[model samples]
Target: MSKPRKPKGRPVSGWLVLDKPFDFGSTEAVSKVKWLYKAQKAGHAGTLDPLASGMLPIALGDATKTVPYVMDGRKIYEFTVAWGEERNTDDLEGEPTQTSDKRPAEEDIRALLPKYTGVIEQVPPQFSAIKIAGERAYDMAREGETVEIPAREVEIHRLTLLKAETDQAHFEVECGKGTYVRSLARDMGRDLGCFGHIAGLRRTLVAPFGEERLVPLEKLVALEEIEDVEERLAALDAFLIPPVEALTSLPHVRISDDQVRRLRAGNPVILRGRDAPLPTPEAYATSISGELVAIGAVEEGEFRPKRVFG
Candidate 1:
């Protein structure tokens, strides 16, 4: 008997969900996979801290153009926050800044969790990617700069306290984009009369991608699996939004070979009969037939292409 031979690589462009390994930066992992797949382009849907692992969506080739779609997708995470202790960075990577001999009962954690749900204000950790004064916040923090970052609004759609250990509280959170789990743990501590830091963090889902669909790094790095690897890529139309999202008055244009050419050249051709959903905050190109050609940003009533693909 012979093992099933995998395909060489995906012919069409798209995304793949990865179960990221701990201790690896998103850029490092992306670089490795992008090279292995020989993809002309690649990027992740969202970022996960090096200590945090799970569901990292990697876009390939043309699919890279749809990154914004995935970036805006909600994320789900399961984490273990060690309570009664505080860290400078709010995670295992930071040094302990404080600790408490007191412990919060499981019931206490449960009762306190509801206060974080829904829209809330949160201050991002000083050691974060957020930009401050034209430099990365983390950079300033590392250089020993002390600056107070104002609290901003972030939505925590669902935050459930799943369990409580002697020194840790396990939780699952489904939150809107930009919600910082690091800050969540820190603030949660202040709310509970103690300090806390993330002991373990894992992302279970990023909107369309779930844990079940995730492939681990070890499996992906197997050179033996190269054959048929292309089949793993998501379809080109995977980024397609509902027709209701189309622009009014751009009524479907069945792109001819010529139109495809012009659009490929970066021209915003006219669509007859108009009638697309109001241009979204960021515009996207749709064919006369309504297939997404590229994402566009609307300016002065015209949609200009941003990221385009064949």
Candidate 2:
């Protein structure tokens, strides 16, 4: 009888969500996973601070192309602010800038939370990745220079005070990309007629992925013992949506073998099968089987593929 053959490890393509471990920098986490998997290429969609732990998506192989879409998704966080205090780093990591002799009441803080809803001005903490003079703002701060990071507009979709105490209040917020929680806490203190700083911060979700899907560092570290690692990967379609077409406006067009060849060759095709108004610039192009094949737009009577995936 022939001996049974052991399964050979194969290359993979997908996104992996790791519940980032506290104290592990985003770069370190990526490196660890890359080394463990012996993957040739890996990258993260968005970076989470070493101090902040939560949903972090790591893209493997061809899935790296979808990272930008994933990173642009809405983000949600649960954090706490220490009223009557301000910090340089805006979080517990920095030295106190100022401390108030009094704390704001819970109701007062709750009332002010709504003020942050919608658009707002946010001056990112000097100790941040923001760039100034071609160097990182945080690096300038570390060199003992007072870096002035200009205020930029960021939107806050929702801000709710989850709980409150005398000196601190818990909060849950849903905000757009680039909105900083540390900056919000700092500003919240100022709103309360006192200084404030972020104390406890946790990112619960980066839309499409939630806390329920996060795998903590402890669990990730133990993954070495587990045989299957595919559970953490996000499907390719998770961030992609098929193009919208109305039956009244246009019907599904089947791409013939010749057209498929043309599409593969990056040729512009006059889709006669397009019975209705083809697709808008935002429409997703897919195969006849409904598999996302490319994103394209109609121009000069030809459908040009903005992005193609065979």
Candidate 3:
């Protein structure tokens, strides 16, 4: 009998901004893009719901090392909420659990926005990916168990009401990590006296990437059908955002070749300049050649490598 063959894929690296399609799960979206690039490693910055679509940053190989930074970045979402009914899952995919005959006026909806804006406590939906007893909260909810998740503080920088109708409302939100739009919509409905659930959800921006950088799945699918591997790969490479680009928001210090060598070897090097502004404890250190050397912390005027790129 022949031995089982292992799959062949490239050791490709960098990030792909995927315009995830509606009804497609984040994991499946990552898998499809990984296969398209034939990457040895892959991961995503944020989990976009299957019912939601837009900006899902897929990181391959070395880029996966910086996913934490991307996830910590602020995100912008534009969603529509359907009024008069509340769903078990807090989204349109769930069964209706309650209904109301009231619809808040435009002025009333505007008044409610301020309460949700700024720093506030939010309880995630019962059908969320949050962990409960080492199992997913959604799994417990699907099994018909009541899951009570604790309310946690989240920053909502902006909450603008884009439009309003008797049965539906559109809004845009810019928030920090851990903010759930579903929860926001659900609570808004409750506060307004008309039950609501997220009817449509789309993430428009995740720091370091925005709508302009998003490449649709259809484009990658087209590349996959090409017979020539080199040609296909070259074409696909055009979509790659350099791995180091993920650290753009961080303060960067240029290092000499010797310092680069020291960083790659996991050593700390003293930085000079009495007049220069002090770097943040955590900052990106790059080579004079514009290549990322390491993500390091400044301690006593020394750049100490925390994670080296090589």
lDDT: which is higher, 1 or 2? 1
Q: For model 3, how does the per-residue alpha-carbon lDDT over 1-310 read when each residue is reduced to its tens digit?
A: 9999765788788999999999999999999988888898899998999999999999998889899999998999999999999999999899999999999899999999999999999999999999988989999999999998999999999999999998999999999999999999999999999999999999999997888999999998988788999999999989999888899887788889998998899999999886333767788888888987888788788888888886
lDDT of each: 0.75, 0.72, 0.92
In order of listing, the candidates' clash counts read: 19, 1, 0
Task: Estimate the overall C-alpha local distance difference test score of candidate 1.
Answer: 0.75
lDDT of 2 by residue, 1-310 (tens): 9999744433455556777877789999988766665566678878787788787877765556556666777899889888887989998889988888888887787678768999988999888999998999999999999998899999899998888888888999999888899999888888788898888878888766666766666755654664555543222224312222111122233455566667667776676543534555533445576544545566555666655555
Question: Which structure is stronger by lDDT: 2 or 3?
Answer: 3
Against the hidden reference, what TM-scores do the models get? Answer: 0.78, 0.81, 0.95
| Winner by lDDT between candidate 3 and candidate 1 | 3
Q: List the residue pairs that clash in candidate 2.
A: 85-195
Supply the TM-score for candidate 2.
Answer: 0.81
